[model samples]
Target chain A: MTASSFAFEPWANTHQQRIEQVLSGVLPTDELLPERLHSAMRYAVLGGGKRVRALLCYAAAKLVGTDIIAADTPAAAVELIHAFSLVHDDMPCMDNDDLRRGKPSCHKQFDDATALLVGDALQSLAFEQIAASQAPQALIQVQVLAQATGSRGMCGGQSIDLQSTGQHLSLAALETMHQYKTGALIRAATMLGAYSAASTDHALLMTLDQYSRNMGLAFQVVDDILDATADTQTLGKTAGKDQAQDKSTYVSLLGITEARTLVRKLHDDTMQLLSSYDQAADPLRGIASFICERSF
Target chain B: MTASSFAFEPWANTHQQRIEQVLSGVLPTDELLPERLHSAMRYAVLGGGKRVRALLCYAAAKLVGTDIIAADTPAAAVELIHAFSLVHDDMPCMDNDDLRRGKPSCHKQFDDATALLVGDALQSLAFEQIAASQAPQALIQVQVLAQATGSRGMCGGQSIDLQSTGQHLSLAALETMHQYKTGALIRAATMLGAYSAASTDHALLMTLDQYSRNMGLAFQVVDDILDATADTQTLGKTAGKDQAQDKSTYVSLLGITEARTLVRKLHDDTMQLLSSYDQAADPLRGIASFICERSF
Candidate 1:
């Protein structure tokens, strides 16, 4: 497909459905033993969210000329990690939000204990998905996923977020927190997809990583903008939560107009990083545009 | 070392220290950024417990004649999983206990949010440890640990336990709960260790697994006995909390005498499973005996 003709909307929609199906097949069926936990796991994961991580993974894999099928496991695995993080973050002890993706959060849909187990099991299932892959790169993939999810990455970012609640954070500190909490997994998504190829040069990996960083931060900036300006219905989650909880965010640090300006810069940087590649890079470029421009 | 000449006491002590060292080195230091979370992760894992899982892993690796060094990652990984489970299981939403390993549980030591993140981070760290292994079996090792930890394994068992609370369960049901809640990880410890070898036959894996099953059940029975008979000091946690919470246990169902009798039978069966192996299996034999006979 030519770069000009390649469309992000159809590609994203197709893969969103694709990952939902893959995740549905991978999660334990609700009919099995521990039926409640199984049901809650499926409930937490199998439904609604933008599969941004999975799309990024597939785009990066395609850019590296690997069979896109090789991207499936990492794509699904990153989505599982994302799902688990959201489930835990919504618990009473954390963000204490009641709405998520237009449904009651996992803890509200199930009990707190079940939600806890759902998050734990989903995390394990993510690794299980990655480990099931037969590629020679699978070992490194596990390492990458784990590193992104662990104390120094997503969880660490979360710790800072929890601590910073009700307290203002400097712009640098906020960015650092976002780097660990969200950027780590976002970067891993792209890196994992690229690694699906037989050989990915260090330079290419670094370029994709820089692009992913820009996109990850931009994604969060847009989220802050939406939380500030969108209604709960449009956001599919409680709006104005960051302000209500006194949590620091991009829009809080910089006004809405500034946050929008920052997103544009990030989008431009993301595009520049992919300029060396051909039409296969179109999906990534398209994703960057979508992230910065989307209303919710 | 010849099986007859090997001494369980010294072997156990030496390996226990080795694992403690390995875990300490692997866990992020408390002095780092997000220091509290890192500190909590270290506190939840290091300087406590018998390292029973690690010992089982090393023993099984010894039996299979792999370079014992190859066993370290899996050994530490299993212990990390065990620590994470305990941390979460102690939460008010779950077990609601304040004491664990004789110290305040993770939630009590830190706040509930930190405790939750500690559990999540440690679980990720466990996979990271396994992924860091250079062995060809590392991919399978990740799969084994994830399967043992997820819905079909430890978390699934915990889910059953949560659902069964304050309700009497049949002997078969209770056994099934313990099998998933505890048996799966114990079995994984041995299996992971065995997998460290260059090649392990399916039959040998089954034999080791059977042996592990007997040991795992016996370990839980002994735990129930200790919970009933031992002091908080001896057990290093709240004593009799199971009965206080109206949770079902082998001791609760079988009476002390019958439970003791079951332990004896399980110990004997474990020994029989190891009969074909010579002295290299002595550690496994010793561990099984310890599980059934220890007072606390």
Candidate 2:
């Protein structure tokens, strides 16, 4: 809308605002019983972050020729899962980070136990989002989301990433790790949109999986590059902490320029896949480029 | 059946073995990728507990004339949720317990990150278990479980327990705490059984809820009593840790003798509720008594 290099900004902004409203409306307020846990859930989730998963979900739904409402529930669920994972990952025994999205991490603002419950409860809320939806394929949607986020996918990737920290990781190993960790959920977001459709286009969903995997890897590569080079204020987190902590990252292994090229290459691959579709795929193409290009 | 005081032992033993088989068959083993996380998940779950939740689920289903297969899915799902919560609660930032089920805790056996992922993936798998089931009430089953375990229920209780540590808790406060923390899942265990039926009897479910609430409270009171009096070897965990951590318990506030009477009263209330049901309710009545009376 503002005539930036990206064409998807206005559309993404609309979806972001809509998703935030949905999340706000759905989440129980802190004023209720179990006030502390509810407050922490809201605090952890409502704290600002890029709603990349939601945007992707909306885009995928549009490409599949489905109602936006069909996409909303799964999108919200994916975002909650993301938020919960962040809360757990930032705890004292894990990343131990005190800052997230320019705000105190959940474990910092709330105590560890409260933060732990926040994450746990948010995860249940995520699944409830899908279950509560009136979508025809709601059960399949739950299965897809569950498989993507579970141990063999995102969780498995996290295990590999944790093990690979400070170890000499080959490029192939890094790709596999990101594929499971970030790529799996990103892939799930896209599949959720497709599954939300009354009748999914199997061929198109397969292609979208490719787009998602590439986009997910591109996202992580950009993250590592930003972590290596950006300032804390620019990144809204403690930048360079990965390098400081001796974690092996794309930037650390291949340098920033090469990582940037990889991002562009992945972007081109995603866009090329989108080129075959009609105008409905524009949102996805725009989002693919925007996510790889955006600062946050 | 053995000549034990509980007639459910024959039935309970059957369900327990079946549940163990289901769990063992379903969990991704250590031989697969991300071996440590998988191993820790199995170690934490397969390590051994009384399988009280599974027994309750099966008993509830039997009362409503549902197939055992209908109960197995939810039974395994609830147990997985139980196991996941335990892994996270045992982390250093939470209860800081070192021993669980006579073995090192998840985080102690594996690194913290692996343990965290294990809990997360287990939760996903739990939802997946329910979603993958062919049961007719699969959606309601998920909702029942998600509501029971989420912020307003089990996680909420944990937050209160964390907050109440070292504080002088009123008896009502203590009841509310246990009702949420432990009672919710145990309650879910029963509700899930009721939901798993093809056509649920709402009145019976309502009665079962009362039975579950009283049984859940009685279970917790016995737990507190055992914590104060049982040895760690018998309990398969660090006994008396509650008092060591200054957490309030029924035994702590009421003294062991009074707490025992409360247990008996709750037990009588639960048995009375079961007595009104048909002959099919025998397993539930027997298990309720066994859960209240078992030393472990």
Specify the highest-DockQ model's number: 1
Clashing pairs in 2: none
Q: Report the number of the highest-lDDT candidate.
A: 1
lDDT of 2: 0.86
Off by over 4 Å in 2: A1-6, B1-6
What tens-digit string does per-residue lDDT give for candidate 1 at B47-88?
999999999999999988988788888899999999999999
| DockQ category of candidate 2 | medium
A108-222 per-residue lDDT for model 2 (tens digits): 9988878888988998998887888858888988888888888888888888878878898888888888888888899989889888888887798788889888888888998
Residue pairs that clash (backbone atoms under 3 angstroms), model 1: B102-B236
Per-residue lDDT, model 1, residue B74, is 89
Model 2, position A260: C-alpha lDDT score: 87
DockQ, every prediction:
0.84, 0.74
